[model samples]
Target: MEILTGSHERAVTTMALDGRLDALEAGQLRGILSETIERGDVNIAIDLSAVDFVDSAGLAALVKGMKDARQAGGDVKLVAPKSADAMRVFELTRFDRVFEMASELSSLVEKW
Candidate 1:
C-alpha cells in the first residue's frame, strides 16, 4: 500500500491510504499516522477511499491515531469509505462520530 499525503483546507494534513488495512499493515499505518502527529500536525484526515479492506486491527490503529492526535490538541478524521462492510465497523464502534466521515475532500473543506 502507498500513502499519498496532501493538505486540505490549507492546514489539514490528508493521508490517503491504499490497499489492505489488516493486521499485516495496521502497524505501518499506525507508524505513519504517529509520525504525522509527532510532526506537530494538529488537523489530520485519512482518505480511506482507496483502501479496499480494513480489519479490527486497522480500526484500532485509526483509534490510536485519533487518541494520539487529540492528546496533542489535534484531531484525526476519516474521509468517505466505499467499502460497506468496513464502514460498518465505524458505525458499530461509534467512530462515525469520533471521526468526521466526509463524502469527499470538498465536504470536509466546506465544514472546515
Candidate 2:
C-alpha cells in the first residue's frame, strides 16, 4: 500500500491510502499510526477511497489506531472507501458503527 500523510493547520493528520491493505501492509500502517500518535498527532483522517481491498489485519490495525487516538483525547476518522467490496468488510465486521466515517476527506477535514 502507498500512504501519503500530511499535517493540517487544524492539527489533524490526513492520510491517503492506495492499494491493498492486507497482512503484508497492515504492520506498516500500524507502525506509521503509532509514530503519528507518539508525536501527539492523535486526530487522524484516513482517506480510504483509493484503497481497493481490505482484510482482517487491515481492520485490526485501523481499530487499534482509533482506540489509541481516542485514549489520547483525539480520534481517528475514516473517509469511506468507494469500493463496495472494500466497504463490505467494515459492514460485515460492524466497524461501520464503531467508526466515524465520511464520504469525502474534505468534509471530514472541515469538521476537524
Candidate 3:
C-alpha cells in the first residue's frame, strides 16, 4: 500500500491511502500516523477512496491512530470510502460510529 500526505487550511493533514490495507501494510499505516502525531499534527483525515480492501489488522491500525490523535487533543476522520469492502469493514466493526466520516475531504477538513 501507498500512503500519501496532504494538508488543509487548518492544522489538519490528510493521508490518502492506495492499494490494499492488510497485515503487512497496516504496520506502515500505524508508523505514518504515529509519526504525524509525534510531529504535533493530531487532526488527520484518512482518504480511503483508493483502498479496495482492509482486514482486521488494518482496522486495528485505524483504531490506534484515532486513539492517539484523540489523546493529543485532535481526531482522525475517514474520507470517501468508496469501496464496498472497505465500507463493510467499518460498518461491521461499528467504526462508523467511532470515527467521523465524510463524503469528501473538504467536508472533513471543515470540521477542524
Query: Per-candidate RMSD vs. true structure?
Result: 1.5, 0.6, 0.9
Candidate 3 contains a number of clashing pairs equal to 0
Off by over 4 Å in 1: none
TM-score, every prediction: 0.89, 0.98, 0.96
Q: Is candidate 1 or candidate 2 better by TM-score?
A: 2
TM-score of 1: 0.89
Q: Over all chains combined, what TM-score does candidate 3 have?
A: 0.96
Pitting candidate 1 against candidate 3, the one with the higher TM-score is 3
Instruction: Please provide, for model 3 over 1-112, each residue's C-alpha lDDT reduced to its tens digit, 9 standing for 90 to 100.
Output: 8899989879889899988999989999999999999999999999998899989899999999999999999999998579898788889988889999988888888867
- Which residue pairs in model 1 clash with each other? none
lDDT for every model? 0.83, 0.95, 0.91
Encode model 2's per-residue lDDT on 26-111: one tens digit a residue. 99999999999999999999999999999999999999999999999999999999999889899999999999999999899899
- Which candidate do you rate higher for lDDT, 2 or 3? 2
- Candidate 3 worst ten-residue window by lDDT: 103-112
Best candidate (score: lDDT): 2
